[model samples]
Target: NQPGEVFYTEYTYRPWIQIDLQQFIVVTHVIKRDIRTPKVPPQDLYGMYVSKRQWDFVNRGARACFFGLTENEYNCRRPITGQYVTLTLEYEQDSYLDALMDLKVFGLPTGCGRSLGMTTGDIKDYQIETSSNYKDIHQSRAMQGIEGWCSSATDMNRWLMVDFIVPTEVQGVILHGWYQMKRMFIYSFVVEFGLQEHTLRLYGEDGLDPKIFTIDSIQDVHILQKFMFLQNILTRYIKIRVIDPSNDIACFKAEFIGCQVYGNKL
Candidate 1:
């Protein structure tokens, strides 16, 4: 939140607000709120842009546009990877002044990794399934929920699966274990993905053979862990099979990081 009068650009041909995230992030949406003034009207039109290079918004072009609103949220059609986000206001006159109450940008800090929509709820509860879940801790809690997915203590061959419903380019996954008691830290796991569940291929160092990723047992349970594929996998389904679970429980929150195979630029 910001004071309405704090951020103001003097009258200019292109009144804009640029935010530096300081690190690359995959931007999903941007929200702008207007600061009502006695004489100056809110911007009627504006452009939103994201880019790795500082001036790419001007070089490549604006990513999207918003119109006829005092406050608006611009959802990017495709996840954009960038270190900078700029919102440029358009006015009919040669020069205009703009004031904003607030500017918010939502994204995942995966550098060039685009979101697969897990954080934004594009992946629903039914789209996620587990081999078995602990009592009352459903698979739906695997992502974006306080209680993450946990497998039954007695269940073997525990695995969590996600169906994107369309072929997506998956680059990596982000995982978080149970945070409260040094529990649910995954020690080792195998990643499998494919267009069909039955014909899934193991994601390995060479993208051809089977390999299990190992994690230190003493690692912090509350910290996020990221696993990147050697090469991007184009698939509709992905499964994480626990090879060695922390305290024999396959429990964790997971986000599959990637983007749609085809979509218009934001």
Candidate 2:
């Protein structure tokens, strides 16, 4: 939430304030508040729009609601699915200055895109274990940080494992390549999961054969790449084994997505 008022300069024409909802959602309504201030009166808001495309902020996006005159809140006739919500000013005055006090958007998450506390700190440091690390670069760094986990260059048997502690329905994983002085990424990797680390099974179409996922090219480096499993797996442990490490170093950041299983057992 932003504090104070957002004002547009006099020279700025058709100024707009945009909010990124982060993920795609089904927006039901939007609220615009104009708290009365002694020095500056509430500026008029003329348009409210939502869009899945980042560039479509104006007329191309779905119109949530429009106010001919000043209004406190706006509601859409139908729900709009989008990741961005934009408020634009449409008026006849060329040099008019507008100020927006506060804006609120109501929506629901599209899918099981919610993080399972990998970067959110719900999963503790001890929960993440690695085979080996390069100097001070530990496994915990993969949770959330610029300097991610880097395995020792000499260690050929490298793997990073996460203990969910409880049974979890893991849907997907968000992987980010490590970058600092030099660029490092995983070219390909294998995913394994099980109730016990000793008897882990490979993630594949068939439970016996190994499934290798390739990163394709170096263009994917330093970007968050998501890999959704073919089917939801119920397990307490998930391990990622590097098959092809770039620069002979397995370095990356990771976040798991899914919800905890209540009654299901392994």
**What's each prediction's TM-score?**
0.56, 0.60
Across 1-266, the per-residue lDDT of candidate 2 in tens digits comes to 37875755465567667887856578888887655442434356567778755557655555454544445566777887766787767665564435557788987877544578767778887888888987333433444655777789788977889999988888777788765777766778899999887999889967668878777565646666767677888889999998874448787778887767777444
Instruction: State the lDDT of candidate 1 residue by residue for 1-266, as single tens digits.
Output: 64545467878766777887855587899886666543345446667888655566665464553334444678887887776898876665655535567888998886445557666677887788788878343433334656677788888888888889888888777777766565765678899888898999788786457878776657676566667676778889999988883447777777776657755431
| Model 1: ten consecutive residues of lowest lDDT | 135-144
What local lDDT does model 1 show for residue 34? 61
TM-score of 1: 0.56
lDDT of each: 0.71, 0.72
- Number of residue pairs clashing in candidate 2, backbone atoms closer than 3 angstroms, sequence gap of 3 or more or interchain: 0
Flag clash pairs in model 1: 63-266
Q: Over the full model, what C-alpha lDDT does candidate 2 score relative to the true structure?
A: 0.72
Ten consecutive residues with minimal summed lDDT in candidate 2? 135-144
